[model samples]
Target: MPLAALIVITILAHSAFNGSRVTISLYALSLGASPLTVGFFISLYSALPMFLGVAAGRMIDRVGMRRPLLVSTTVLVCAVALPGLVPTLYPLYVAAACIGTSFMVFHIAVQHMVGETSTDENRRNNFGWLALGFATSNFIGPVLSGFSIDLLGHRETFLILASLAATSLFLVYRWRNQLRHTVHDKPPAAHGGAIELLRIAELRRVFICTGLLASAWDLFVFAMPIYGTSIGLSASTIGLILGSFAVATFIVRLALPWLTRHIREWTMITLTFGVALLAYTIFPFVSSVMLLAAIAFLLGLGLGATQPSVMSLMYTTAPEGRAGEAMGVRSTVLNVSHTFLPLLFGGAGSALGMGPVFWTMAGLLAVGGKIADRRRREVSAQGSG
Candidate 1:
């Protein structure tokens, strides 16, 4: 019942967070911000998270999930509500920063709960369900926000997001007692920290792959709005394009348990990145919204599978009593890319064109995948030896 409740909580929270994400770029543009400024807004969303993610993760490990979860959800209500009240470019930046920081708190806590509650036999499937919750919310959030913006305009759409966030807070508060408290049998060794975790070669490989996959997804969210606008797509059309990607993600996540049974995780990761390379390469050339949606769906299918697999690997690889810290480390790496890549892409989009930005991201993912595969082979050969 607790796990089920967690899923429900995640769906609402993720829906609110993603709804903000899918709209923020367009909002920035609407308020007279350029591509470069939009990048700043996107990067600002991760700046606080990038710096404080590990500390936040450690806090979860030290205290428990319930408190942080409550706090973050409460923060989200204010965060999503801010832009609606002010409705300006500066307020959007404040909204981005708050949303990013608050979500990081909420996410690391939930991941810790999921890891602590599940065992080896059921971990993969359990995480799959969590991923599905995220996918479902992703589908709902963008589409709902898109339609809301078309009908209600931007300010009122943000109101809807705040309402969803408020719903998440209420659910967590109601179920607070049902969520179990996990006490580590022994304290984690103080010496190692995130640095020591990085020393394990297999874990390192997982981080690299996960980071690349995460950044690709982030770039897609940021780029799609600008790309859609460039080709004269409506706000509603852009929402559908992004929402279709989420829908594809939802379908893939539903099949993940079965996919895990038949396909090795690394193999799946490699294939997904390969498909994404093709998707991004073709993204800039397509002008029709339908074609863009089709490509986005394909990209979503690949991107969605990578998460459960990589997250399971991270939890499995983490040192005892330190899963939260490891999850934070994962969040930190992703946020670092989230922090910088958008700024770089924004500048590139302004100077060169969106074409170069897409190709550059594809090339990075391709190279990262090859490195991951090579590292896996080396690890395998050593195990046999």
Candidate 2:
């Protein structure tokens, strides 16, 4: 299959997985769950991934993406359907964790497959397309999820999402041959473990930046429903707010070739933090949906441009034949924040106020932007010297 076809499949499959986050959030809240409890549910999505990320990556390196991708997609199909089967809070807990873990495996494999197949000239561009797939799915997921829940109720929405995954499963099975990588015959990179990969200064810097951005991204997804509910926004309205953010990401990623040509990756990362910080700083002060969505759009423009650069940087910087491992390690770094931030922000939001939660994230973004800017300066100095 062509890269474009795979990207199309990715958008189709991921729309369900990504959009489920909001549906799950709204469903949990409709069940009388508190903010802190909702945080716990969101946290469950990252719990297993935090622990198993590296092993999944290494498994991909040792075997191949085809098997893992197939197995993981199968699991995701089951995971997405679990809630509709049971239709209870407990089932959602199981579903959230399973969905997160399974998608982690599937995502890492797809990324590794994409990176390994592309040459240096188009590697970044290809990842941009991949990232664009994610942005499109992100938009489709939330909007479709929001409307689906409003029109059909949550259980039916889950079923709809599951059908999408089942469709993806069929496609993956049909194209199974193309999924195998050339790297499988080669020996794995020599290093002690993930620790050795992290020890490299470049990877470490990207990891730190990745973590901060992940925290920002997770908080928005996990917190948006609660935040919108607190302000009495309808389910559809809240989804639109989230959808606006995704649209901004789509618009930015759509312009990546031009953006990458004009701006450096680390430089772009720094600007995203600044954009996110400004968004968070304004988030708490708004009550109207239009105002909120506008702010979300601004933040999306900032963070939307990040993934391709980050993935390209890691793939290029990591030790030979270890791109999968590097991607997995990135997941670990991301899930660490994904694992903890919902509870941290949820509790703070409950105890103090939404203002405090936004402020705290703004503070983190400030520090992250500084770190990214320093790296940008260092890169410039080295180039000019």
Candidate 3:
């Protein structure tokens, strides 16, 4: 299938998954779950994905995307629907874990498919298009989730998301013949494993920077609703704040073609850290919904711009036939952020307040930017030499 088809599929699956994050968080809160418990809930989304990410990538490398894509999408449909049918906080925990793991597999497979399908000349733009699809879904997911919850209640909203996922499952099933298995046919070298992939210094830095930006991204997704609630914002308003962030992602991605021409990849990433760090630094001080959305928009621009650049860099940097595995390693790194930050920052936010959580994240961003800058200097020096 073409990249456009993959993007369409991605937008559907991702929208469902993204919407579920807000729905689950708010639903748990409605049921009297505390910030710590909410954090645990959000953390569960990353738990299985964290451990399984690398292996799933390697598996996709061997099996191709057709079966895995259908299977994962089906799993997504079931997971999203479970909460709607059960309508309980405990069932949500099960749904969260499955969504993360199954999507992790689907995500890696889709990315590999895109890279293999594209050439050097158009790779960034193709990925840019993919990111645009994600940005679109980000908007659709949360805005729809928030409104759906307010209009129909959380359970029905989940059922609505499940319907969106089911549509994705149907499309993949229909298009099974069109999907290519993979590009890299040679077996991954025996010496090559996750650890070996990480040992490459430049690719390793890409993983590090990607992880930090991902943490910032996931942090907002995980925390925005909780913070909005603490300060008396309605669910719809909280969703709007998150929605504004998605809008920013869409805008930056729209400009990616022009940006890539003038800005180098590492430069874009390091600058993103600075941008995101600023957003987080200001988040705790602001209480207005508009202001929160503006900050969210700003953070979105920063972190949003990073995904295409990071994916482009990873694909270009990987040793042949190993791009899927490389992506898997990157996924592992990202899931670590997904899994650890919620629990860590969730506990921190619960005990010390959201201000500490925001500021602490700012500290991590500062470190991430410093590392990226150092790596950029190394790359520049190598080019000159």
Candidate 4:
């Protein structure tokens, strides 16, 4: 049931995310909005998710996953469907916000579910599989959406996404009874307030590390395509580069179970961050499309490795029976980074050009790695005691 839910959700969510920029940006362009307005609309999508993520997490704990999942998926289907009907910038922005809200709800609920279902013995593997599922969707969604849009146009593409989301909703409904049973059968444990959750030392370190790394991840992913275009890459070439990145990410995640057994979680986290830093530093220097694709592949491997490891660590460190809240906090911090980092990088890129922005991203990764190293040492020391 978990695997089924993960598969459907990944497909629908990725389709929405990958198709949204194309649909919304084109919609805004058609409405006579400037480049700046398009940027604002994109920023709003990320910002809305960050703003609602923690609240969504709390709501998931307060209620159960089924109600929120159903409601959020329903609203998202409507949001996707509405844009095709109205075709205006205001309505498009509203739809984007709704999509963001739905994503936040779905994200929190799913992570909580994954964390709750797996034992410590298999937690990392479970997360690795989840990451692989998401990466696969990320790989497939944009390419499919682009092709569909070319054949059917943007409005039609959105309607297709709406249909996919509805299919996901139906899957969730099928598993509804099982989901409630899982939630009810779990032993009672502390349901900490947000502050109390934050007070767990290991969990706090995980949050900080996850947030900082995610900020760098978002900055690179958001900025890279625009940067590539500025250097004369075709739209299709840019898509291929990003798509290759996703492919590499999926590949690395498939190997994570093996990798995690051989390397300490902290060591893997540090190594992935270092690789990411190197990729960002070298990103602006590459001009050839082939070379850029190579760098993107390396970047994807690093970025992909970091997330599941962090999630696994957080799940293990979380107080017993509070995995839901811990996973919720992890998702919240990640969503927060997703919200702001792009806007920050976009502004920086606008002011100083792509080269400088890439350099800035490298610096951020370096800083994040240093912090993670310190936190890992602290965790190790605490465990030893």
Candidate 5:
């Protein structure tokens, strides 16, 4: 298949998989799991990816994207399907883990392919388009999931997601040959372990900022449904709130080329953090659904730009032949944050209620915003000098 077709099908499958993220939390709650337990449940989604990311990256470098893509889609089918079949709390945990692991593998391979295909000239532009695909899915998934739950109920929704995953499987198999690169590029000279990639100061900074931004995204996904429920919002209403975030993300991604030309990338990262801090700080104070929707949209504008920025920086900063490894390392950091933030905040929320949880994230984002700002200034001064 052409890259365009691959992107389209992948977006469809990804949207399907993402839809489950919100519904699973609500389903788990219905099964009598506590907020803390739900935290652990959400953590399961990242735990496997947290550890396997680097290895998966290395594997893609050695072999190719085809096998990993096929395997991941297959696993995705099982992950979403099993929940519909079992319809229990334990299976939801298993499903979350499966979805996380499979998607991580699939995502790493797809990103590696994008990096491999791009030359230095259009790399950032390519990543911008890629981020658009992701933003579109993020918007489609949660809103669809929300409405499905409200209309069809939870179990039925899972089955629909499974079918979506299956479509991805079909696309991958059909395009398996095209997915492999025919020509190989020279590997980076250092050619050390994955850890060696971190030695590059710029890559290190990218990882740090990526982790912070990615974690904030995770927090909203994991916490918002719970918070919305507490505030008496229906599943569809909660989905609309989250969907609003996706819409803003889509808009930002569309404007990214212009934004990149004007604002510095590092400055954009810093701005996102500050914006997120403000939004999270106000989250607890807002009672109206429209107010919450507005906040979510603002958060989306802040968070959506981070992915393309971080991925482009990582690809450029990575040593030759190590783009996949760098992608993996970034994945590991994000998953680690994803895995821990929920567990920590879930426990905190259980004890202190959701207000403290959002406040804590706001505090963390404030610190990250400062660090990003400092880095941006130092880069600007160095360039001017």
Candidate 6:
């Protein structure tokens, strides 16, 4: 039941996310907003969410999963609906902030729920399934949004997303009793405040890894489309290339259960970062849309493999009954990268060209991999003792 609910929520949330950048950009353009204004709005969506993630996590722990999840979903539905009703830049900015805030709450709740429900032995597989659900939704979202945008226009796309988000509320409502009883009913002995969550050494490693990985991921996803267009690719081609990445992500996540069982978490993360480094290193040299699609697929595979492992590692390290707070801190760290890296990439792209941006990302990924590898050895040594 929890898995089913999770899948529904993933589909709704991922679709909205996939569509949001393109839809908002187009909507803002229609409203006579300058490029700088559009960029500011987009950056707001990324930045605000990081700040909210920590608070949202606390809310989930305090109230239990169902209420926060429901509230977040409600806010998301309303946020999605606003673009259609207001049809202006300022209102859309407000909508984007709301969407960011709500998504942070919703994701933290879901991650906490998954952690609470699973044992350490099974947490990796559970998170892998969760990642799979997210990837599948990402796969479906862009293609659906592209066609919807073409067929119904951007205004209707927002309305459609709003409706989709509303469906998540239904799923959560149905599972409310189950989630509450499962997570909140047997509260643990009081722990220190949220700041103390930072004291977990293993969790610190997870956050460090998350921030680095997220930087690479956001840099690639945000910059690639703009770079592709600049190089004269059609919208359809860009969509196809993006879709290919999503499909590859889905394939990797499907195999993650078997993969996780056999491979150590650090080994998996190291491998992912290595592959990602290769992908970014070569990405700038590819000109053909078809070739771009192939590179994207490889990138997606590498990127997709890392996240669930990282998340599982974090959850395993979390103190009993404080999973929500731990996951929230992780989310905050991850989203902080998502918020800032794109701006840095954008600025670099403006100054040094896209080639430099790719190389810079590649360097970051390589460094991240090395750190994860080192930490893995340390952890293994400690475990053996």
The backbone clash count of each candidate, in order, is: 0, 0, 0, 0, 1, 0
lDDT (0-100) at residue 285 of candidate 6? 89
**Lowest-scoring 10 consecutive residues by lDDT in candidate 1?**
182-191
RMSD of each: 3.4, 3.0, 3.1, 3.0, 3.4, 2.7
Error of 3 at 366 (Å): 2.5
lDDT of 4 by residue, 1-385 (tens): 5665666676676567657667777767878999988877776666776666666765666666778877888887898888888876788878878887787787777777776777777777777778877877776666677788779887888888788788878877777777752343342466446678788776776787787677766776788788988998888899888877888888998898788777767878888779888998988889989998999899889888876678778777766555666666676677677667776777888888989988877887788789778866876798899
Q: State the lDDT of candidate 6 residue by residue for 227-299, as single tens digits.
A: 8988999887888887788789889999999998998898888888888889899988889888898989998
Clashing pairs in 4: none
Ranking by lDDT: 3, 2, 1, 5, 6, 4
What is the alpha-carbon RMSD of candidate 4 to the true structure? 3.0
- Estimate, for each residue in 31-98, the C-alpha lDDT of model 2 and write its tens digit: 88887778777788888999999888888887878888889889989999988888888888888899
Q: Quote the positional error of residue 93 for candidate 5 in Å.
A: 4.7
When summed lDDT is taken over every stretch of 10 residues in candidate 6, the lowest stretch is 180-189
Poorly placed runs, candidate 2 (over 4 Å): 22-40, 85-91, 150-155, 183-190, 222-240, 282-292
Off by over 4 Å in 5: 22-40, 85-94, 146-156, 180-192, 222-240, 281-291, 350-359, 382-385
Q: For this target, which candidate reaches the highest lDDT against the unseen true structure?
A: 3
Q: Which candidate would rank higher by lDDT, 2 or 3?
A: 3
Candidate 6 TM-score over all chains jointly: 0.90
Cα deviation of 380, candidate 3, in Å:
3.6
Each model's C-alpha lDDT? 0.86, 0.86, 0.87, 0.76, 0.84, 0.80
Worst 10 residues of 4 by lDDT: 180-189
Which candidate tops TM-score? 6
| C-alpha RMSD in Å of predicted model 5 compared with the true structure | 3.4
Which has the higher TM-score value, candidate number 1 or candidate number 4? 4
What global local distance difference test value does model 3 have? Answer: 0.87
Per-residue alpha-carbon lDDT of candidate 1 for residues 1-385, written as tens digits (9 for 90 to 100): 3788899989999999989986888788888889888867777778999989988877787787888999999999999989899887788888999999999999999987887788877777788889999888877887889899999999898989999999999999998887767755455656477798899776888888878888899899889998899889999899899888888998999998888777666777888888899999999889988899999999999999877778788888887777788889899998998888777787899999899999998999889879766755765687799
